[model samples]
Target: MTQTVPTPAHLVRQRYRDPQPTEPAQWNEVLRVLHEHRSVRRYLADPVSDDTLRLLISAAQSAPTSSNLQVWSVVAVRDPRRKARLAALAGDQAHILQAPVLLVWTADFARLRQLADDHDAPLEGADYLESSYVGFIDAALAAQNAVVAAESLGLGTVYLGALRNHPENVAAELNLPAQVFAVFGLLVGHPDPAEDARVKPRLPQGAVLHHETYDLAVQRAHVAEYETRIAEFYAEQQLAHSWTERVLNRLGSVASLNGRHRLRASLENHGFRLK
Candidate 1:
């Protein structure tokens, strides 16, 4: 049986649901994988082997780190019981328990802190808010690299931002040391074909990609266009909410944060002096 190859234009059209889609100037395997990404929540019982996990981490480490500080680490959780506990802490997302592995990515300053303590040196810069941003950014970059690598390998993955809902609990559950903050969780496994997940449409390129100065006023028109395009995507998934309404509901109130409003205090408790 001949497999139908998706051209760059097809993928781009699927991504933005653009009415008049244009073919990409260039295309490659990496671009194809990136454009076809979809979060897989349902998974088979198949286990992700240790060898595969190591490969994913190697890909993650290949990502560019801020100043090469590489202030990131990942904890691979495969134990069913531990995953269950973490699922409980993270809004009880069943996917956490269903997936064979849950990789808890962390912004790690503890390694550098330990090095400084051994050398009897003061690391005052790490106390600054800039350093915190660096750590978070580095972790995100590394995790994205891992995601790309995982998708390229035909494995399914989904990010679990809800891991931050109870930061202290997650830290304790993972036995994390001071200065090592859990950035987020990534569930990796073989996707259940029964789930039938599809590529989620995104905002138009004009809405985000700016050449020079950012134009705030033009965003309204772009977003209006996006609403129409993304409505078809929502309808296919049987979703009733509009994109604007969904985002508004997500951030319109303090209650929408789901206890993340105390993140500052949680960071302080975890020894992150966000100065």
Candidate 2:
């Protein structure tokens, strides 16, 4: 028997786990791909080709940049031994080792710094916190574009924020220079079919989409509603987790940061003045 294809309405419903899902006004393959995204934890050992990696980088470059500064770059790691060492530093996530390529995205000012040094330019603005934020934002936008591109090509990806857990170690492992910080890691490869990961539900539209003015007063109700919906989502996966509890636990204390709380010091060590 052939499997049934889900309608656009069904895909939208699956995204939010909505009991009363309505048909979207507009729908296309891009929308479908964006909505269907799920983090693949298990992957096949099949290697990603250099051509495909270049294509993904091209797609990433197409994403909008702030002021056209383009202060980001990526290091694609495929060496098994190097990946294993990185995996050890990054919370020992098996997926990091399993994936064919680990793309280490960086908030890089090194390129601009070189240009400035060569021309004797001041580059005082690069030392400010705002400039750092721009680099970080630009890197995130680029990586997200790569994620969409990879998924569109039937490849799987999962972001590894744990790369920041030991920033100094990861920087050393990647041989990154000063003014270049490893913002995060992205694993890319063919997904293992056995895992069969489902779409993780998100909060209700009203909870996040604030019209004109922000409505802090009504967010509590939205959270309550989302709790019940996501509880069922968790139960289906045999994972006894609460979204609220997870958030609190993940951000409740300095211990909870898992060593990322020292990120300011790490950034400073990496030559960001953060003035």
Candidate 3:
């Protein structure tokens, strides 16, 4: 028997769990890949070749930089021992070990600093909080590009934000310089078929897409609609969760930050003088 394929309409509906998703006026392979994204927690032990990795990095470099500063860098880890060590520091997620490559994306300023020192130029702007944000934003944009590239190539990926749990330790493990900070880790490899991961639902566009001024009152109703639609997805995944409760619990207290509350100090230690 031939397997049935999902149409663009189905994929869009799946993306939002919308009872009636807007049919795209234009559709293509890129749209399909984007709408079908699923973060794979389980991966097969297939090695991602250096050639493929290089292509992904080139795609990442194509991402827009802030004023052409290009303040981001990445460290690719393939050694099982190093990956295991990073996995330990990053919530001990099993996918990091199972995946063939762990890309450590970093907000880097060391290169610029070296250039400034060599030319005896004053780099006072790099000491500001705005500059730190620029570096972090640059790293995130680049990493997202690489994610899209990997997914288009039929590989799987999951972003590990918990890498911030022990920022100092992660920097040490990666041998990152003082002026560089690990923003996050990305696991990339062949997805295990047994996992059967599906595209998770997101909030209704009404809640997020503002027309002009924001409407806080309308957001509650949209959240309610999201809760209702996503509940079905949660049930299908056998997950006992409520979006409201999860959001509240995740930010209820300092403890919920999981050591991330000390992020300012961690950034300073890494030479980011967020003045």
lDDT of each: 0.94, 0.95, 0.94
Q: Give the range of the ten consecutive residues with the poorest summed lDDT in model 2.
A: 232-241
lDDT of 2 by residue, 94-147 (tens): 888889999999999999999999999999999999999999999999999999
- Clash count for candidate 3 is 0
Taking all chains together, each candidate's TM-score versus the true structure is 0.98, 0.98, 0.98
In candidate 3, stretches whose alpha carbon ends up further than 4 angstroms from where it belongs are none
Compose the digit string of candidate 3's lDDT tens values, residues 21-108: 7778999998888898999999998899999999999999999999999999999999999999998988788888999999999999
Q: Could you give candidate 1's per-residue lDDT for residues 1-275 as a string of tens digits?
A: 99999889999999999878899999999999999999999999988988999999999999999999999999999999999999998999999999999999999999999999999999999998999999999999999999999999999999999999999999999999999999999999999999999999898888898887988888899999999988998899999999999999999999999888988888889989998
C-alpha root-mean-square deviation, candidate 2: 0.8
Candidate 1 has its poorest 10 consecutive residues by lDDT at: 209-218
Off by over 4 Å in 2: none
Give the Cα error of residue 101 in candidate 3, in Å: 0.4
**Roughly what TM-score does model 2 have, to 2 decimal places?**
0.98
Local lDDT at 23 for model 1 = 93
